[model samples]
Target: MLPSTSILFLCFLCCLSPIVPTSLNLTLPHQHPDPEAVVEKLQWKLNVSLSRRQMLGNDGKGTSSGSPSSFSCLTGNPIDDCWRCDPNWASNRQRLADCGIGFGHAAMGGKGGQIYIVTDSSDPDPANPKPGTLRFAVIQEQPLWIIFSGDMMIKLRYELIVNSYKTIDGRGANVHVTGGGCITLQYVSNVIIHNIHVHHCYPAGNTNIRSSPTHLGWRTKSDGDGISIFGARNIWIDHCSLSYCTDGLIDAIMGSTAITISNSHFSHHNEVMLLGHSDGYVLDEGMQVTIAFNRFGEKLVQRMPRCRRGYIHVVNNDFTYWEMYAIGGSANPTINSQGNRYIAPADVYAKEVTKRVDTDEKDWTNWNWRTEGDILVNGAFFVPSGEGLGVLYAKASSVEPKSAGLIQQLTLNAGVFGDPRDSVSVGFSGGTTTSGSSTSNNGGGDYFGMIFGGSAAPPPPSLTITTALLSLLVIIILNSRHPLLYYIHPLLKHST
Candidate 1:
């Protein structure tokens, strides 16, 4: 055995390790928030938002078609209309905390924290990040409202590991996270990612990375997912553009729940979004996600959220193209799809929007999958299965869904709407190709090119995967006999 001093030092560092779940912002596992109560709260918020929307479409029929009155900046998408239209949004960014309206509505990210401005756009040192860099901002122990100083593209050399109670707000700048491992929220909670572009993310790992100011641990190879949520809760991703990744654009698994993915754009990829891991991950049974007010656009193949055992709400979105099925699942998940537009491709065999992977008809017959007021065009269809789940949906779908006719208007500003200078596209997969009509039938360019272009600043990439997956897991094994190096910090230089 080592000396007493050496043993104490090892224990201290172990507590500071990112993998240890030592965060203070969340309650202990024994004192975990009640899942049923969380669902009830989400139901209340959605019902409240629905009650406020005078969803009198032009024809006064919500079941058929119509839209909100023309005299307002609001688009009937409760989340976007809450803050995107405000002229003073940049000044009162924190007010956005009150605008959340779904399972993640309780995620008050960085609301009580001080604002942290990221003025540096440099590639970060995974072990010793410099102050003012985006890496430094996210690794802090305290809550922080992080925003960019100007328009810039950040290509991270490592996977970005975000801490709890933080908000990465990219409202006014042309921010992009590309070229390396993208955002990873692991064993943390209460994070808000808004108004940025996340695409062309590649896998990165096999290095020592920092989490808190005092912790630096070895990392593993990451899946190139744009936003990877692993064992986290209370996450909100809104108003971002995502495309062209080696893996799923946004993947949440390993018991990650209470998530809201809204007002975003996804395109030019194979597997689009994944909500659960392999079908055998029983821990994911508690996962609950809200996919709302987004546009699943051109060149997407499948997995507009391939789910597993969990409760999923797919509401108020637009599905334009999918080479394969749009939504798929296994291991008995409750899917509540309401008030969305699905435009199937010309492929006759792919017209059906749902697929239950490997599960037989008899077994999946009782899984609660239903669609309410969804507009299926171009012969597209959703074959829903299952039996009575009124109680589950009552809390999930209390929000009277908006009309599908208003999808274009609601998702028109889905991505980074800006000028030519405000965006960038780089991917190993085929990208920059428009899958559907570029022009809108409504005279305004809101379709493929229909997606209005705009400029805002961006963040960078970071590594991701289970337990950090294949990479970080190896580190954990090695750390038993040989701990990570903390003394490497003095050699790394940074701003005062």
Candidate 2:
């Protein structure tokens, strides 16, 4: 054993460390607001917004179908049908703001913002984009709802750095971003990228690129991700077709949180989605992402996101094919796979959906990766890990699981739809709405749950917090009995 002096020195060093409070009882007087009351208020706010939209569409009439009076049967996919079938959908494109499901449900991308029309497809100068270009619309600091005037393939000279509060709406047009650098959302918030095709993104640049209207900085080589969410939050990417990117089609990294990638079709990609930056990046622990109602189809290999450390809610997506494992992660991410349809390839080697990258079985066994109500086809298997309990699984899941059979219907209209038609118009034969649609043709009540639903789990126990708290508590209890006791007493008092 070491001498008492050495023990005392070690204790002194421990005292210098920060003290973390336990169970935090962060609930001060009225701090612990009633959760139900908060939910009800939020529900009311959403209702009022929807009702106001209806009023505006109907010119004060009480018609739930908005204007034009012609109503189609609900598609049962609450998120897609919420605004897709509306006759005034083009006019009220902002209604998509209310359509997000999961952690990003609150991402009201450019809602209540002025509309900006992008008439130009050319990007001659990325640093100083013309007013009519997509780059210009995205760089503006103000909230903007951008719409393409016509179908066009935009080849970017550099990666498009999108600013906060921007919505790139690609409905009613076949907008393809290809053969160049794609979108990068760095340190921005509340961005919605919908109904666009993002493919063939090539790495470019070691030059100045304009991030915002005022700021232009030299950017290093960007990994050709179709969409890169870096240090950003509240991002909703919906109804986009992503394929053949140089890197991940969609990547959320560097503490990016509150994201939902839903109703998107991802195909012909190698590395698909990536969440968190690196294995050692503990800041990404706060990341919460929802991957829902997407089609992971055709020639996809691994990492339908390879998460690092985050709460990843993968639900209701149709994984039609994958050359390699579908979902992978390391650093103990909490992955909740629910009601998804995973169809493995005939390659016997790639039958499993889960991949614990470079981790030992003993270590990965404790990672929270759970599958609930998933339909695994073609010998597809998910190697579930962690505490396989209802509460633990519920904590990881963002929304309640629907029937696994509904996966086909949920992702039926997965990609960007050029035209709005009855579910049959999307090419499904004998298309029928879900049971809920029969009673609620008018999208009402619990609309938030349609896309981004479910409250997050309580905070996980922190090792640093626990260790420091125990050490500090001990030193305080043994005050003056130890040499290091007095050193941390002031810190203990401050913490308490």
Candidate 3:
């Protein structure tokens, strides 16, 4: 008989042979030799050094410094004037004086505008305040929630730009803005709009009457964009929830830059965020915007904002059930999309490729090349052609004829449908020709319907088979090791 040690060694060698699982058919790409090591290296590179507050700071400090003046100090019945009658009012009278509409005047001094209090329902009347007027007032000890009862709408005639460092302190009461109108800001910086619920604004373009032509305009169609910012910079929109209107949830047209939108939830809108010009020209600089830590869900269709010649940084946003494109860019913009959690449907990959192809054919080679990183599970490639275009590659299955046909369609649709991805083909792909259209369509098309054909069929299950086999092989190797090869078994065998 073979010696015990030799027999055990031979058994170990037998167990060491490759064990493939029964369920697998197709070959899998080789597993990375050290996946954990690869992840470690990537984490080191992608780590962001700034803290959450530091990254989202308004005016260099991330925190809101003071309580809003609108609701600061108050007892019972501010409109009734009972709190002003107290005996100890002298010591706290300064706090009460500081409590009203112009509380920030000490800090603001003469540089900011005056403060006006709207005590009655008559204050917002266009006639009372008059048009092109600046009225500042404090409601005095009244909870800020009182401002929402259609009282603020009376001041519609005057352009109500909250200067003098105004704060509508809620003082534990909720202040909401309902009904729709434009709030215009001129030469205003270091502004903070916080802790307020603004909703049910009337749709834009519905009313025939007009406010100031240049500073403020009439309510037009409710495209669903809740708020409007005209020519404002260093603005921070945080901790707010907006719903139920028309167009985009937040529309930044014209040239508005250095804006940060963080820690908000958006849903039920067509275009959630829009950053571009209405006329489509390259301005001096586009909007420099950052979107982070927001949650999105169940969009009706593609709802990405268009960024033109701007810097957009999208990080750490969770997208649950994105029915259409989660994020998209346009114009000659720079977009950085990183650290996002996305749950996309199966056809997302095919749809994305088609969109890119369509975008490249438009705009006559004006599309800028930027970096894009996406994570997909069990996706496949269908190349319309077998070559890589500039920053664009046909999937593996695309033949030259099919690629050419698709390119031709893309060019024709360019004039009618603008590039949604805002890509223009500058150079030719290998064995491909460049084409153009006469008119501009602003990157709109039915490419998705064509690429997907009908309903989006589920992808094949080949990936599942490969994964099962790898797991089975690992299990087999671990279990097959010798029972008596280690220390406990060697002594017993030797005694026997």
Alpha-carbon lDDT, every model: 0.69, 0.69, 0.34
In order of TM-score, best first, we have 2, 1, 3
Clashing pairs in 2: 101-451, 101-452, 102-451, 102-452, 102-453
lDDT of 2 by residue, 1-496 (tens): 3347656865775675555343222111111123223222323433344344445545644365544433232334557756876767888889999877667777878998999999999998877888899999999989999999999999998889899999999998999997656998877889999999999999887778887778887776777889888768889999998889998899887667878888888888899989988775555666778787888877788899899976787877778778879999998887876556666777899988889999999877667666655655656777776643333322223444333345565677787875331221122112221211121211211111222222334345244544444443443434333444434323112110
Over the full model, what C-alpha lDDT does candidate 3 score relative to the true structure?
A: 0.34
Candidate 1 lDDT tens digits, 254-277: 668888898888989999999887
Error of 1 at 244 (Å): 0.5
lDDT, residue 288, model 1: 77
Error of 1 at 76 (Å): 1.8
- Best TM-score among the predictions, by candidate number: 2
Q: What is the Å distance of residue 339 in model 3 from its true position?
A: 1.4
Error (Å) of candidate 3 at residue 154 is: 11
Give the TM-score comparing model 2 with the true structure, all chains together: 0.74
What ranges in model 1 sit over 4 Å off? Answer: 1-71, 388-403, 417-496
